[model samples]
Target: MSTPARKRRGRRAYIAGALAEEQVARYYELRGLQLAHRRWRGSRGEIDLVLRDGDAVVFVEVKSAPTHARAAESLRPAQVRRIMMTAQEFLGREPRGELTEMRLDVALVDGQGVIEIVENALSDF
Candidate 1:
């Protein structure tokens, strides 16, 4: 059980995360990427954003923190693994899965609510 203050903080965090996702989605949309899904969930975990980038499918993991570095650092290996698994599940259900190129991206949201998208961010991982 959580105290009232803790509960409030948790709710605040959830709201912040959701808003961050929306901002990131809009940022991608402005770049000509069409949003395929938001908060797509599977048995493994949830993908923050799924977008169609031309002939490629992009899976974006959004992180929000006090700073851009902190936001980027928040994506841990375990979380990446979970996101990857969920992405695989998402692709499996798509009819054009094999035909489309896949990409993993990260969107970092800073304290000022600025979004910085890093494409192929997980490629070397």
Candidate 2:
């Protein structure tokens, strides 16, 4: 049983997430990366943004919260695994397949809409 208030909150979160993704995409684009896909979904999971930097593929996970640190902390280990799996699925479509060079980045958006990009945020994964 979903209440009206709950639905409204869910809608608001969705909108905020969408906006954060958009902001992150623009941030990368300004830095010379070309947007390849937005909200790319695979059997494993969804990748918020996929960009191309030369021949390298950059998979970005966008997070939004009251603070940048909170946004960064929101990405759990389970989600990291899912993102990695999804990234591999996405790479399967590339010309080099799984051999394609790639990196995972986390983009954190604060309440005021400021963006902070953590490059290679999941290098150890």
Candidate 3:
């Protein structure tokens, strides 16, 4: 079979991403953290979302791939570096905030419309 042309992400993928982001936000909200930002942008990079979990400041990275493996895999080394740098820039803008409690988190998506939140999965940054 002629390899069925790989389906590029279109409206459906966009919808999935949006839905995942929203669900992640809801989860963080229920956990007592306020969703301070959604799709926050900076010169260095873009942060998917930010939440305040009590005294903690969380920088969220939301990934919505077809499967959990693919989704989690997307957060490769390069991407992590960018996210970290971007987070630094993001924090620079809010110097008054508590930088000591800053953290980076990932929200991975599966094909079943489920989101798995992985907190501090990476130790590097």
Candidate 4:
């Protein structure tokens, strides 16, 4: 049976998500953070992009929205909880040892080519 048009649109949406992630990763790298991983997964959840700065590992969440408001709203409380859980898992698996100095950062990509970055957007859970 042929897949419906809706399913095809969903697949396209997923691909766009990947492209936005790459853009955000590059944006962070340009700002001097070392790129560690993208779409990094742990048992708890997935971190969109993770970067290292000296001794600190920063867990990043990237939101790509057709509108600025939509992008900012993507960081709902429940979503933050999942990212926090994933960060804990990442720390436990880190070979570098010290994970106490880590923080969470957020990147929002508006379809109009505007990018908003927030560091320490949310307090550790």
Cα lDDT listed for each candidate? 0.91, 0.95, 0.81, 0.84
Note each model's CA RMSD in angstroms.
Answer: 1.5, 1.3, 3.4, 2.5
Q: Which numbered prediction scores highest in TM-score against the true structure?
A: 2
Write the residue-wise lDDT of candidate 4 on 1-125 in tens digits.
36798799888878878888888888888989899988999887899999988778999898888986898887889889999989988888778644457989888888876778888986843
lDDT of 2 by residue, 1-125 (tens): 57998999999999999999998999899999999999999999999999999999999999999999999889999999999999999999999999999999999999999998889998776
Candidate 4 backbone collisions, by pair? none
Could you give the candidate ranking by TM-score, starting with the highest? Answer: 2, 1, 4, 3
Cα displacement (Å) at residue 3, model 2: 1.3
Name the candidate that leads on lDDT.
Answer: 2
lDDT of 3: 0.81
lDDT of 2: 0.95
Q: Which stretches of candidate 2 lie over 4 Å from their true place?
A: none
> What TM-score fits each model?
0.93, 0.95, 0.83, 0.87
Per-residue alpha-carbon lDDT of candidate 1 for residues 41-112, written as tens digits (9 for 90 to 100): 999999999999887899999999999999998899999889888988888888886455899999999999
Total backbone collisions for each predicted model: 0, 0, 0, 0
lDDT of 1 at 64: 99
Error of 3 at 23 (Å): 0.7
Q: Taking the tens digit of each residue's C-alpha lDDT, what string does model 3 give over 1-125?
A: 23343244465677788899998899889888999889888877788898887666799999988788899888878878878888788777674644547889899978787889888865554
